[model samples]
Target: MDRVTVSLDELPIRDDLRGQKPYGAPQAPLPVALNVNENTHPVPPEVADDIADAVARALREINRYPDREFLALREGFAQYLGHGLDASQIWAGNGSNEVLQHVLQAFAGPGRSAFGFGPTYSMYPLLTSGVGAEWIGGTRGHAYELSPEDAAEQVERARPDVIFLCAPNNPTGTPLPLDVIEAVYDASHGIVVVDEAYQEFAPRDSPSALTLLGGRPRLAVSRTMSKAFAFAGARVGYLAADPALIDALRLVRLPYHLSALTQAAAGAALQHATTMLRMVDEIVVQRDRMSATLEALGYRPSESWTNFVLFGGVADPAATWRALYDRGVLIRDIGIPGHLRVTAGTEEETTAFLEALAEIGAR
Candidate 1:
């Protein structure tokens, strides 16, 4: 009995999955949770009432399969995006992750490769592998910035079937310049996905990759309700691209993948877009405050256009993470050497996180 070893390694798993660990982010109930970059603000009562009413109406038809086309939801999204996109050009999924998977499944497969700038969203390589495609991690320049020349050069060499560019990127909080997006789009013969999951949090003047969608048949821009809409639990994400590209996604997506309740809830939220997104201004304020605090303590905080700040120069990020956790404030240590990411919470939560970390940083 003592010699018996129990483990998943003994099972017959896919060769590619061997020794691979499941994705992990701390979900423990802490005094303050700024780890996942979630919009910490709860849905306003007025907006919540509207969503509840919509979902309740949807519940009456719960026995039936949801709309496979999700046209109404698409129309809602098109109206919200307001970039002259029609319903035919918009596609949605359970989340931006699922939307990404749909894009890869439809465009990438065995014998094809995908490329992304290094130290960006950690999910890019994982999603590439999930679609049975080869993954190429391309290098970014200083401060995790993707330059046009580097983007073009890498795309030319890899000649990948798919390319992912994350704007206001996940852990680094570095937003890509539009010229870089165009350079990659021009260089790539295959599909280009500009993930704008954090678009709502960027500065007003920060250009979105959506602006470059015209005349670029191969490009798509992905966005989500999770970040700024305070709709993470609704699990709605969408993309805008050429109608032909959206049609291709239809081939791979499972029928009725988005439930009726989800569509109804998201549509309701979009109807109250102004109210749902009101917290964004407040979050941006706190984000800048966090940046200022980190810099004042002599840490190198990345220039953030998102609701989170990535700071560097931690003598020991792991220890600091542990120290913060001990104090009931949780943040993310994204495995980037000497850096940590913290989401902007409410004023009180932000104050607690900042005060707790200040002592640790000083020590």
Candidate 2:
């Protein structure tokens, strides 16, 4: 017999997460925040009032566990999607981030592998690691576009057990075409998780994987109230998948993962769906104007389908970021060597950012 002693620090941690930063962004305030891709508009007062009313009505129920099924919220969300699915087809979590984690847990890990395009959502790779799965990084076409042909080829080769496709992808803000998503879904042998966190800002024709859910048992779409609904602090995200897949998620989730207050707030937000759509239209218009402004300023901004734009191939992005910070503008420096992502804020904030950029460029 052999005996060995191991301390808490001595146990071997997962190799993929050896040097990753944990969640939470830097805490700093600036005049213009063109970072983190948050909706610039504040939640309307009427929406807030609705939330308060819902919360007040639910206060007495706080002592009991929240509806374990989250049936009411799911039904409301499914109706909002315009495509009807039973409550059994939906699941809620702390955020779409957690929903993604559940998908990874259910499908990928150990011998199984997860694949996502490079320069896609950074969290995809991070989540793959956190779930003890092999993260396969695939190449993208020019302009950070996700190529369906390339993804199909990789799917045939790597045979990943899980795949993440971010429509209107982060940082670059380019959306993958519908045909491409369909092709990838057909090609994938494992679960195809389509993350549509920014679909509200995307063009109306932008392909949504939700329509193909009937036959594609492996397909799931993750959505959040964070962006278009201006509910970042509420931390509410949901997934629409086949009822069987949703049931699998229920087995792994922690109890009461979503608070009663958050459920009430989300339910209330759904009541003013038309108002939310109007706000999204306004933000889309601002995004287009901002893109034009960037081009007019002699900086090439990537075509965007989301609420932000990515400017690539800059000479010194770190210096540029620092200069913007000094000028009371806070934009994201993606640490991708020469890339920066600027979120669309209000008109005044947008103007300030552009002016600051022009001044910085001259120096």
Candidate 3:
């Protein structure tokens, strides 16, 4: 028998995905990589040791499937959240993206629609389209901020089955105020999935949508340890909603979806959550410093509550990006015309990036 090769165009494929590429940031080697908004610090040595020990213990159970319920891990999230939450109120997946997929799968199938304010996570529309759900792009102000009145009005007009609120929004670094969340909830009769992936970097007084979960069975707040806990490699993301809502997630989640090693690693990280969060203040400090420096150098940076800052007013974003890359520093060009985003790393890393950027601006 002869083996034959085929091209994607010659085979059956979903219409929605015919021309789509995988969603991700560029992966290139450089001396300073602050592109993906990742927490640049490594896991603390003590915490890494503990996690290593935990993984070694979990290896003994490798012969068996992981806990499908992931009860202990859910309990850890509940304890971490501490809004009178319980294990029943939390759901975990490989990452918050998976958790989001579960939600969309449960509520946003064919013919239903989802909505998100523009310039948010690039995945929102892709996820909806992949599920055969219609996607509506809602409006934001010139500054990329959404107001309560605008949110409520848009939700009413779209009549969407699912709505995404990306607080401390990715690539933008601004958070949605609670009133805006509440207003959207009041106007929409569908599920509200607030993506708080960058919540840990938000200001202390910034209200979490988790606080609005009570009595609003249709509301969910997604979170990730990938950013603040420096657990991007572990891929632990979760959501806290009503118990009934959590049960619906189980319907779509495959058995043993989270591997034993992932559970072990994330649980161990949670054990030292405080230590994992120790660098957040420093990151914020560096974020502000970087923003001020950029503004002084003539970049218009949006006020950031997250570890990264999105700045505009560039004559050419690609040229700036290329200049930084050539200088051994790297950041993200989020395809937002003149805007670029940079992650807050250690002071040394911050200095390296700023110096590179300054040099390019000087030329």
Candidate 4:
């Protein structure tokens, strides 16, 4: 049989999707891959063994569908988050992206719009457009900071059907204050989502948006096991909101959306939350180290509440990125004119990236 091929344009695709690029970072088999803000540490062996045992136990009943409500997993998240939350107030999906998509599906669609500060998570606009909603790119203040006053003003003026606040914003690693989240939620008449994928990496004393959930039904805080738990490959993300808001997402989610194996593995991992999060303290150390060294090397590294650092002062981002690549290290050139982002990997990996960057400067 002859192979049949056709370009995307030749098919009956959505007009808005045409010419739109997908969101992703370069994936290379380098010695040190620190582009994505992944927890580069390996999961503790004992915890991994426990997860394996749980999955094996779940495999015995693979013939039956998983729990539609995922009640136990919700309970685990509730306990982990512990802002007086309950399973009734929880919802989850394969990843944080899907959780956000469910919110968009339930709240925003054709003729409605979703708004977010510019240069935030690259997926916000993509997810919005995927649901046939308009994406409003609101602006951020200097150094990608969004103040309470400015944030509230933008939300009020845009009046979008949904809004996303990437806490400790992606790519830039700038922190998002709880006051700003409060202002945005209060100013908007629609649903507001706070993505806290990196919340575990933030200062232990720093408060989470989860604290703001009281009496605010339209506000939700989404989290992922991918970052702090070193479970990125497992694809577990969850959210906490008013029970009413949680039910709203049910309308858009597929039945038995989470698989039995996934639920089992994630539930088991949650039992070892303390062991799982020990890596976070080490990662934070490397993140601060990277900032100090980058600044010493003439790059202005931004204050990060996440597992990565976005540094400026690179004369040419592409060349610096390429130079690092050639040295068996990988980082990100997130399209900022003179900025590059690198995850705070293991101490050795972080050292490799910094050394390669210094060598490039020398040359």
* Per-model lDDT: 0.91, 0.84, 0.91, 0.94
- Give the Cα error of residue 312 in candidate 3, in Å: 0.6
Q: Candidate 3 residues 1-363, lDDT tens each?
A: 999999887789987778878798888889899999889998889999999999999999899999989899999999998889999999999888899999999999898999999889999998988788999998788888888998899899999999999997876887789999999999999999999998888887777888999999999999999899999988999999999999898888888899999999999999998887778888999999999999999999998889999999988999899899999988999999989999999999999999989888887
TM-score, per-candidate, Cα-based? 0.97, 0.94, 0.98, 0.99
lDDT of 4 by residue, 52-96 (tens): 999999999999999999999999999999988999999989999
lDDT of 3: 0.91
User: In every candidate, how many clashes are there?
Assistant: 0, 0, 0, 0
Q: Determine the backbone clash count of candidate 3.
A: 0
Point out the higher-scoring one by lDDT: 1 or 4: 4
| Range of the 10 consecutive residues with the lowest summed lDDT in candidate 3 | 168-177
**2 or 4, greater by TM-score:** 4
Estimate candidate 2's alpha-carbon lDDT, on a 0 to 1 scale. Answer: 0.84
Higher lDDT: candidate 2 or 3?
A: 3
Per-residue alpha-carbon lDDT of candidate 1 for residues 1-363, written as tens digits (9 for 90 to 100): 578766888888777777776677988899899999999999999999999999999999999998989999999999999878899999999999999999999999888888888888888888888877899989887788888998899999999999999997887888889999999989989999999999999988877888888999899999999998988888899999999999999999998899999989999999989887789999999999999988998889998988899999988999999999999999999998988899999999999999998888667
lDDT of 2 by residue, 282-349 (tens): 88887888888778877778989999988775789888888889999998987666778888888888
Candidate 2: residue 250 Cα off by (Å): 1.1
Report residue 19 deviation for candidate 2 (angstroms): 2.3
Clashing pairs in 2: none
